[model samples]
Structure formats: structure tokens, C-alpha cells
Target: MTRRRTTLLTGCTALALALGTTACGGSGPVTAGGGDKALGGQTVTVAGVWSGTEQENFQKVLDAFTEKTGAKTSFVSTGDNVSTVVGSKIEGGNAPDVVMVPQVGVLKQFAGKGWLEPLSETARKSVDTHFADVWKTYGTVDGSLYGLYFKAAHKSTVWYSPGALTQAGVEPPKTYDEMLEAGRTVSDSGLAAFSVAGQDGWTLTDWFENVYLSQAGPEKYDALAAHELKWTDPSVVRALTTLGKLFKDEQLIEGGQKGALNTDFPGSVEKVFGPKPEAGMVYEGDFVAGVAKDQFGREIGEDADFFPFPAVGGGEAPVVSGGDAAVVLKDGKNAKAGMALLEYLATPEAAAVWAEAGGFLSPNKNLDPAAYGDDVSRATAKSLVGAGDSVRFDMSDQAPAAFGGTKGTGEWKLLQDFLRDPSDPEETAAQLEAAAAKAYKG
Candidate 1:
């Protein structure tokens, strides 16, 4: 079992920092627009694993904090977040006031190890209300909340190039059958319908889960992550059959079936931009847009567009995806003040600002969908709200370290082996099931 955190979301670290600063001093929704004047009299040292663009963006928030409250923040840049870095810091007694984690599972893992400070009820309600109760309850240990979410990046949606889609004569796909048909049409029109880099097993794992859960129901994936569901269920097998079927049809994916096994995420990214590219629609999260924008200098709507992971039965589930949470270090400076900041950022006002700036969903429920206003962000928010209800965290992210693919190592190996001989669906299922069992044991 491997719990691999992705590197694609470094941009999110900036969003988290801004939200952290914004979160520090609000009341409740409309009533929550104030900050703590007294807390700023002291300087607090903060450390985290953000760098590059994320750091620049965070500085904006820090500058604002320093300006507003006179609270000086000395942020140490920790290049990458690892358990060893956290352990070493705590053991060295050099803890920061707040630690922003890339995933919820890490937050819970640390909480279980008793390294985090429990936040106030105000902090909990402020951040947690933006998400479903399951997310709020799952990360809490010792009956206390330790982390708060600001930006949630949805992974289950599909991104298509608007110009490419128009060239292919395809409208946004709305159903599984329709999506498959669109894939065929694009293939016939000389472009690959789907483009997913397959070097990481979790990349394919995400596709499998989306297909399985969409065909089955949301509960199945949640239960599976909770150790309450079996891997060899009919739904799981059916999903592989679907994958195999897609494999059998070269028209459905970029560079065909072989490309899926050979194309790394980097390769897939490059493949989408050629003069006569082979792929038009790619199944990826909001972060991919940044990569595209960096490569193409285009804004989201002008270049790429995303639609809700087409409603999967019982209407549509809130656009589900992976997200990060910030925890107050028990041993750090300004514990109460950090909590105040966390509370303040989850307000609608901050959410609107953060979403517009950072290009992700802020954990502020009162924010209007239009306020986010990015074509994808607005569509995502609208689709999420329009769906029957409740947003769910990524099953892979919510699952324990071993069960989740957050670390991104073992799953790629597993996927490499699995794709080589997908002739035996049961074998692949058994292998993943064994890994899931090991995760549960841990």
C-alpha cells in the first residue's frame, strides 16, 4: 500500500497560505468579517513545504497580515513535505505556528500521533461546514478538530480544449454513453478522445474509481476506502471490463491503448499541444489547467474547459476531488491566533478572493458560484451545487496512507504490471485488494 501525495498541487500551497492568513479573524459568514487586533502584537514563525509561485502568492497573504495586524510572520521554506521533515522538526523543537498539509490523511496521521493542536469549535464549524460531515468527522481524532480546509481541487472531472472540441464537432459530453460516443467521434476525426498519462498507477486508479463508482454509486468507493467494501465486487469487475473494452478500442484514448501504458503524465501533457495533436479531451483536475496555461499562456475558459463528472445516477454527486487541510501545531506559536486565522479564511468573502486568485475552490459555503466566476470554477461550483448534494473528498486521499495513492510510488509499479497483462481482470483486482487489506491493517 502506498499513500503518495501529488506534486502537481504546489500552486495549492499558495492558496492555502492566503486562506490561512484570511481565516485568522472572522466571526460567522456575513457576521464573520472581523479580525483580532490583539493577537498581531506578537510575531509568529511559520514553516511549510511551499515554494515557487505558491510562495509568491503566500507572500501576498503574509504582506496583508503584516499590514492589517502588525503580526510579523517569518516563513521558512521547506522544499518538500515528508514525514521525516515533520518528525525532525518536532523532535528538534523548531515547530511553526501552523503547518499546511497537502492531504487530509497526513493531517489525521499526525493527529493520531498527537503532534497537532485541536482547534476551537468556531474554527471547526467555519471550515468544516464548507464540506460534508464525513470529511469533518473522518479527520478528527480525540474528538477534536486539528485541521481546516481552504482550497479543494476536484479530480473527478474531465477537461477538454474548447477549440479542439469545436473542431471535432463535439459538445460537452453529459453521460457515460455520450462520452464514449464522443471519444469515437474524435478518434474518427483524427484526434484521441482521452489523454491520461499512465506512469502513475493512481492516475489509472482514479479513472477506475471514477468508472466504478459512477456505474455503481458513491457509497461503494467511500465504503471501500473505509475498509467496508470488497474489491472483487461485480462493480469493480465491470469497471475493468469497461477499461479493457476501452483498451480494445484504440479510438477512445490518446495515442491508443499502448499509449496509455507508455505515456507518462509529462508525455501526455506534451501530446496535447502538437500542431495536429492526437488528443482533445483529457480527464484531469483543475491543476492541469495551470500547466497548460504556463505552456500556452491562455486563461482557463479561453483555452480549456471542464464539466461536472457527468451525473452518475441519483442525479450528480457534488464534484468530488482531492484537497489539503491546515493544522495548528500544538507546540508552535499563536495557537489561538492561528485558529482565529483559520476561522476567518473560510468566510465567503475570503473564499471569493482566494478562488479568483488561486484558481481553486475555497471552503467557504456562502460564496456565490458566480463569485468564483472562472468558467471551470463557476461550472464546477454550479455543477457541484446542482448535483443532488454533499461533496466528497478523494477516496484515495481520505484512505489511510498505505491504502491511498498519495505517495505515488508503489501504485505506478502495480499499474505497470497490471497493464502488461490486463487479460486477467481477477488478478489485477486481487493485487489491489491485497494492497487495500494491508492498508486497513496499518
Candidate 2:
């Protein structure tokens, strides 16, 4: 499945958020702009990565919190790759009350470093019945909250142009051979099929990840992530071979395997929404719903839709990569308000708002799948309904910072590069093993 870009974010593609640290974590009446009540009506600074539709949705949560608490709140647009800035503030003793990021593993490292606080008793108790396994295990380490997840988004789902597929006489693919045939048909019709962008290793990594999930089960990925399994597992080789074949086929990718070398994320996005793009099918996350709606003037399900990533034989599994949890610093002067906003995000109403704005998946399990804005969105929600309930964090986040967190630490790059030449899957596996072994301090 195509995952959206989250890291290596530069100066605010409108996402460089900048809220203040509010009050230190110690004891003191928190301060707000004008008159104040609890915590002395103090204001709290929060930071996270969200600009376009994402920011609008988040604002809804903030707006509700302000109305309920009567606390004045404003935000600075923090760019992606939050750790670069937030991590420094934390080290400098001035981290914001709350921080939002996309990858769960990054937050786990911070929690492990002792930079976070356990969720308030009220918050922790509320989450047990409200979230899925992904949020619980991915966000928590040592039973503490580093990531306060608010939604669920899965990849490994393919979004194709139904009309194009039909016009090209290509049926929705159900098997690996069918998928290849579909791609070929689309190509023969002078239209692109897969909208994979490999210039940046991130997109390519997603392809490899999807292959791994389809070839093996979630258990294989989990074991590999934890360094309990070797990368050269037969399943791994088969998946890589599949990807390599696609790259070898000029008809499979837009601009071919080499074309992926220069494809930027936004560019690939445009290829889908723009009138004359190379491809018609893109495997992306919920976030793209807005991009399609606003840019292509189509709401999810109505304009664009998604289908489960097809598996070969008994390779079916429910493997989804989701966002990081929102965590509040323990000492921020307005910890009370921080917690309030954090909890506010978990509500059904908040989930609805997020769905409305950015088309992100909601962590609030209470959200009615019926509430999805379009057919595509609803279909995606429905696809997950019949699958197992387990969600895996993205592989990139499972390693130490040196591997990939606030930066591209080469963990995913290896997968992307090796997928094109999978003959030596064992060697590639060995490299990942060695990398993890060297990076693992525990």
C-alpha cells in the first residue's frame, strides 16, 4: 500500500508548527492570556506536524477544548520531522505540553529516554476499550503514553481508476498474476497503472513493506522488527522477487524503475489528481482523500476508492501502518489543559472532524464506519472490518534514531534498493540484521 510522506520535512510545507512550552512540568498555577480559572487559566504551547487538511481537523479538537475549558490557545505550524525541533526543546528543558508526530517507534524512543510522562489515570483507563492493538502496543512502552494516538490508517490497499480499469478492460486484480495483467492492460491502453514514486526511498519502502506483509504474516514483520528473525527468510525473498519483477517490467511503473529515482511525493500526488498523469492507480493512506477531493474534485469512495492489497495463495494478512500518538510533556506548565486536549482528540466527535478535514483514519473505534465521507473511504473502512484486528507500526519506526526516526536512517532505504535486485536477499537481510544489531543498545 502507498503510505504518505511524513519525515525529512523541511521548513513548513505549512507543517512546521510552533506553539510555546507553556509552564514547566513542576508545580505552579498555570497562566492563560486574560482571566483564568484552573491552573490559573494559563496557556499551553503544543506542537505537531499537520498543515493542510490535517491542521484544519486538529483545529477542531483545539477549538472544542478552548470552548469547554475557556483557555486561550493558538498554534504555530510545525513542519514534518518533528523530532529535530521537539527533541531539541526537550533536551533544552522547554518542550511543549503536547507533541504530534506520525511514526510510533520514534515516540517509543523518547519514552524510553524518560522524556515523557504516563497518561493521567483518567486518560489511560479511557483508552483500553477505545483503541485497537496498534495504538496500545505501538504508542506505549513500559505502560506509559508517549504517543496519544487518535486515529487508525492502513496501507497495503490499492486505489485504482475504476473507469480507466474498465475502459482498459482490466478487472480489479485479485491475484498477483491478475495485478500484473491489469497493469499491462492499462499500459497497453496508453495509461499508467501503479502510481508508485520511488525517487525518495520512502515510497519504495512502502512497496517493499506491502510485499513483505502479503508474502508473510504480521508475525514475520514483528519478529524481524524486533530482531528475532533473519531478513533472508524465504518469504522475504519471494516478496522481493515479486517487487523486482515489477521494476523489471517497463509496463509496471510510471517512468519505469529508473523513473522512480526522481519522483517527488507531491509530484506523484499530482500525477493522480492532475488531468494528464502517468498513472491511474495509487496505493496511499487516508490522508490522500483530501488531496483527491480538493485537487481532483472527488470525495473518497465517490471520486476515488481503495481495495485491499491482493495476496498470493495463503499470504493474506491484515497489516496496516498508522500514525504516531500525540503525547504531552509531563512538566509543561499547563499539563491540565494539555491533558484535556489530548483526551478531547479521542472522542467520536473529534474523529469525525479529522475524517471531514484530512480524511485520516480515526482511532476512536466508536466512529461509525457509515460516517465515512465517500464510497472509497467507506470501502476502505469496510475492507478492514473482516480482517484480523492486528495493526503493525511501519518498519522504519521500529529501529533506533540512527536507523530512522527524525531522519532517514537507511533502514527503509536498504529495502527499497534491494527490492530491485532481490537475488541476494540473504545479504540484504544480513545488512539489516547487522544494522539493527549495531544500533540496538538494549
Candidate 3:
């Protein structure tokens, strides 16, 4: 789970920073019209896990917030380990006015510790109006609203190089078998079929989740996530066995197991779309497009494209997702300013700016699909909204951090082992169950 958290936490730390700065007057959709004096002369400090390009983009958003609300604002980078930094700040009695929590589990933990402030009426109205019920539900703890999701990523996508697919004489795979065949075709053509980021074990967890959700359906996913069902259940075995199809074959993955075990996530995407193009495809969340463009200057639809993770055994596509939530600390110095920021983020305008910038998706139903920068982003946005209530939060994210966020332990290490030697799903399942039991008990 530590690896999972890093994969998502690092990838999204930038987007979270990008959206943390924007705000407007309380009444309506935030526009570039003008400033209001509501929270004027007040400064709001936001602490979040963001840096680099995300930090720069957030500055622009904050500048917009300053222009629209007349509230002086600044953002603080909380580094990679947000929970530790935030907890220390709170204990020091200097908590940021607002904090962007990366996972719902963390938000709930904060709420249980009485460190978060429930949303004010103004923020509640904005959330109710702009977001879907599910998003609201995720942000609520004990029937009180404490967090608002400003950005999200749909994880059910497999990014591919269209040119490579064409060269392999295959279309986007619709079924698991077809996907395997497509991999075979690409491999036969002397290219690695998929870039498995085995070095980052979280990607492997994602690989398992998508297949499980689609193959076993949402009820089982929910049960498994809530620990109502054991990790050693037959469904998990089926999911692992299915995923093993790709992991077991040396030629199917870029650089084989060794290459995968060494390549980090960004490198995995680059392997597929980099200059030499070692592989044809990579599976990750919607954020990959932005990373590719920003890092390697690859054109999404032309140089790279994506399809929903193909269904396993003829089931429908499953959407697994993760996002950042804006939460007010109980000791917030400027409550009005914090609520104003949340109100603004709940609008389509705030989402549009980040969307056009690339690699952001909002659950705000008020957002126009056209706000996304390109067809690839638009498709992901559509898939998210289109999935409706069927969408499931990323399984590892929903689990307790002990099992989900611990490094070189629990799911993270076990999955890496499974990838290195996928000969035994049963043994891996037993290991997973034992780790989960101990973590959940703790």
C-alpha cells in the first residue's frame, strides 16, 4: 500500500496543487469577472503534497483566486509524506487554513481525530449543486461534510501508441483474450506489448483491481474493499490468474520482468511512447497523458492513445478511481476564506481551467465535457460521468494505510513478488489475506 500511495500520491500531488489555489465569491460559478471584498484582507494558507509543474500551475490558479476574491493566499508544499507533516503541524497548533487530503481514508481518520471542520452551509450548497451524490458521500464522515474533491483520475484506461497498434495490425482490444492476442501480435512484430511498471508495485495492484471489478462485478469489489470478503476468495484468485496472463509471459512486458522491475511509473509510460518505443502500451490513470506531454513532449491522440481496460470474460468496463479532497481544519484561521475556496472549486469554471491545462478530471456534474483539453481527456471525462454509480474507488486506496500504504510490506511487496513469479495465485492470496488480516485488526 505504501507503493500504491506513492504512485497515486506522487502522480496526483501536482494536480492537487494545481487546483488548491483557485477560489471566488460565494454565490455562483467563479468567473474572471471581478473581485469581491467578502474575505478581503484575509490570507488563506493551503498545505498540500505538490511540487514542480503542479506548483507552477497552482500559482496561476491562486493568482486567479486573489483577483476574484481579494483574499491573499499562498500554498505550502507538504512533501511526499503528507499525513506526517499535517499531523505535526496540527500538534504544533499551526495547521494550514485548508489542507488537501489525498485519500478518503485519511480524511476519515482526520475526522475521527476531530481535526477537520465540517463544511459551512455555503460550501455545502456548492457541493450539493455541482457534484454527484457519490462524490459527496466520499467526502462525508459521520454524516458531516468535511472534504470536497477538486480533482480525480479514472484508472480504467490502457494507453497505447496508435502507430504501434497499426503496425501490429490490431485494433484496441475489447476483451481480455483479444488483449492477449493483441499483445502476441505486438510481440511477434518485435516490440514489447506492454510496459509493466513492476518497479512500482502499485501499478500491479491497479492491474488486479480493474480485472477483478470487471470480471467479478461491483458487489464483490465492495465486499473485498470493506474486508467483508477475504483476499483469498476465489474472485481474487480469478482476478490474479487473469492478470498473470500478462505477468507470466516474459516477452509480453517491456524489458521482460527485469526491465519492468527497474522502470519507474513515468519510465513505464516513456517506454511505450519514448523516442525508441520499446513497448506499445501501458495501463494507468488519466494522468498519464499530462505526464507524457509534459515530460516527453508526446502528442496524445497521435503519438499515444488509450482505451478502457478491456473487459475480462466479456464483462463491461470497470472504472476504478482516486482523487484529492479539499478539507478545512477545525482550527482554520479564516473560515470564510476556506468556504469561499471550496465553493469556487465546486464550480465548472475552476474545473475548466485545470482541465484545459491537461490531466485533471472533476466529478462536478456541472462541468462541461468540452472543458477537457483534447479527445483523450474528454473520453476519460465521459467514461467517468457515463459510468455513473458503477464507478468504484481504487481498492487499495480504500483500504487502511497499514495494508495499503506501507512500503516493502503488505500488498505492495506481495504484488511485486507475484509479478516476479506468478506461478502460484493461491500462495500469493494466502500472503495477501494474512497481511490484510493483521493490518485491518490493527
Judging by TM-score against the true structure, name the best candidate.
3
TM-scores of all predicted structures: 0.84, 0.84, 0.91
TM-score, candidate number 3: 0.91
Error at 206, model 3, angstroms:
0.8
Report the candidate with higher TM-score, 1 versus 3. Answer: 3
Over 4 Å off, model 3: 1-30
**Best candidate according to lDDT:** 3
What lDDT score belongs to each candidate, Candidate 1 first? 0.63, 0.63, 0.79
lDDT of 1 by residue, 342-417 (tens): 5445456545655656656654456777766566677666554444235556667666666665454434455556
Residue-wise C-alpha lDDT for candidate 2, range 1-442, written one tens digit per residue: 1111121111211110111112222222222223123322657577877787667777876765565456556665678767777877767777687777667666876676666656654455446545665576777788665567775666667777666777788777877667888888898888777766665566666667777776787888788777677666777677777777777777877876666656766666667666676787776665556566777776556546666767754576445666657777664555556765665564455566656554667665666776666666666655543343566666766766565432344565675566455567667766766666767644
Put down candidate 3 lDDT per residue, 1-442, tens digits, no spaces: 0111111111122212323423323344444545444456879888887788776666666666766767788899998677888899878878787888888778888888888777756567667777777788789999998899988889999999888899999999888888889998998987989998888878888888999999999899989988999999999998899888788888788887778889889999888877788988899998888877888889888887899888898677789988889987766666556656766666677778777776678887778888787898888898887787788888888778888766688898899998888889989999999999998888
Q: Point out where model 2 deviates above 4 Å.
A: 1-40, 384-388, 405-409, 419-423
